[model samples]
Target: MVSVQNRRIVFSFLLLIIVVFSSYKADSECDFKAIYNFGDSNSDTGGFWAAFPAQSGPWGMTYFKKPVGRASDGRLIIDFLAESLGMPFLSPYLQSIGSDFRQGANFATLASTVLLPNTSLFVTGVSPFSLAIQLNQMKHFKVKADELNRAGGLHILPPSNVFGKSLYTFYIGQNDFTSNLASTGVDRVKQYLPQVIGQIAGTIKEIHGIGGRTFLVLNLAPVGCYPAILTGYTHNVSDLDQFGCLISVNKAVKYYNALLKKTLSETRTELKNTTIIYLDTHKVLLDLFQHPKSYGMKHGTKACCGYGGRPYNFDQKLFCGNTKVIGNSTVTAKACRDPHNYVSWDGIHATEAANHRISMAILDGSISDPPFTLNNLCRS
Candidate 1:
């Protein structure tokens, strides 16, 4: 015995309820509340300096106004990614003071390789914190978190909830290639790439074994495009790529990326109900170098902070923000006036500005393999 007006009102109310519920479900699906990262200096927050503690001024002048152990002048790819997810910057696992694990942790360190100790042929002094060690540290963190959750007084989410729901990101393999290239010539390195990638794949599988359902794996950037590589390596004029980068070195990167993609595809099939997004960082970086004006970059081929002349402006003897005695004269490595206009921060790492642009593309899923962007992967 309801009036016609009452019937219409009830229908509208039901429609609103359905819409609200759908929106909530969508938000929950995309709500990646935590993030765990692993890699080298490309993604290291502070793990390297936590152990060595030698970083100083102008290293973080762009954003932090002081040295913060980041290899770059400001933030890193992992930092921007965390910010995009509305999470605070991840604390380096080794950092003791003011560290917050509620969001997640960064286990990356400078110059970390995938190969185990005594296995890397190119790298000289091996650190104890390799990818395997980082994974072990992650396991320890999970155990501690689980204990706290069981205690019921101070809980940082159950380890199961953290690993199962959080996003696990990796930006490794560049150092692996660099180390191998330095020790064993290019041909030998190429021969060993498959084994190296297999080890990387095995590590990913280990993470998968642990409740890790989501992965954001970034492939190697164009290593030849790095000013340090260009300055150090001898390249034939005919072998230079369109961007004047070392063609042979870049070819190796392409080969590695292809193998990595294939390995990830096989992994996807093996690990059911998992989301894996392979980010094409090489292409993105090449595009940036090719069209520097488009990204507001003026010095795409040079280090923003170094003591050297043009073309690369990078020095092997003087690292970024370092002062060295050249012929008994103190020559200091100075930072660029406008770091935002430069792509390479210190001949190796990307500037915060560059990382921001790359991160935006990643968030929108523009440069990801299979077109499943970070947003889509998290929400799906």
Candidate 2:
């Protein structure tokens, strides 16, 4: 027979084991669950270039080991976010060439924008699908996932089962101000910003309506600093960094975010199931610009892949990688020693590594205030 002390020891051991097992199970279930993405090139993994002819070179040489349609060499913001959540990278909607949605999906297109009416960024035959269209695609995905689940096929965890497990990330609004409104003027930014904010809020609400309970909305990065825009225009050198990243543009972004916060607050009050968390990419970008060394970046003022120098920019030939190079013009564009080591990708977009840092920051509960943080919106 066991002694009384031995019996107590056994009971304590059993209780400890139970507690450990419970904690393990909770964490295991939190593995990157479901990822739904909507936005433009910054987060697009290649939806636009899927059908277009291959001419651009710097398109996808870094990550996929070749041009895979994503604007970056490897992944995008959404990809890293998915990874952080312990989920496989979501497939681009156009990558239907041979995709299995059981994992996750992406509806972001290279040139898509948040503008309500939607406008073209360039005349390169890039279709600027609005955010609304992307939302519709997500709805279709939801329907398809349900069908697959009912048919006994592999499927994403249901929105119900995946409620807190799922995360939707948005990286939009830059093109609206840069491609559509900026060329027009800041007045246009001030004029249409309210409508822009409303549409974004409506998009989030729509997602919630369709069982999307958690969202991570990344505000637009500083547009004024894009190498493409900054290098070409003739402006005061003193105000260049602050140019494309105009006070007006940043102001508009702040206003939009403020409205979004209010809208989300009201939304959560009415819809207990839905929650929206705002991530501040704007400040991150600014920090990167002001302090490149801290982020291990070398060139914050110029693109690593474009062609141009001093007082003028001319990357019209698409020279980042090599579908357009004829017999090798010595590869005029420059790539950093290590892309993973750098913060900015190309000259305008954040590299996969940089995005990963930001995503981690969000998870670590670093930025948690209005116009920058969204801790209140995301609750396990």
Number of the top-ranking candidate, with TM-score as the measure: 1
Question: Residue by residue across 266-354, what tens digits does model 1's lDDT show?
Answer: 88888889888788878878877667788878878888998897988898889888888998799998998899998888888888888
lDDT of 2 by residue, 39-89 (tens): 888888767777464646555666676777777767776776665555666
RMSD to native for every prediction?
Answer: 3.0, 4.4
Clashing pairs in 1: none
**Minimal lDDT window, size 10, model 1:** 153-162
What TM-score, to 2 decimals, does candidate 1 have?
Answer: 0.91
Candidate 2 residue 70 Cα shift, in angstroms, is 2.0
Flag clash pairs in model 2: 32-85, 32-86, 57-321, 57-322, 58-320, 58-321, 63-73, 63-74, 224-244, 224-245
Q: Distance from true position, residue 316, model 1, in Å?
A: 0.6
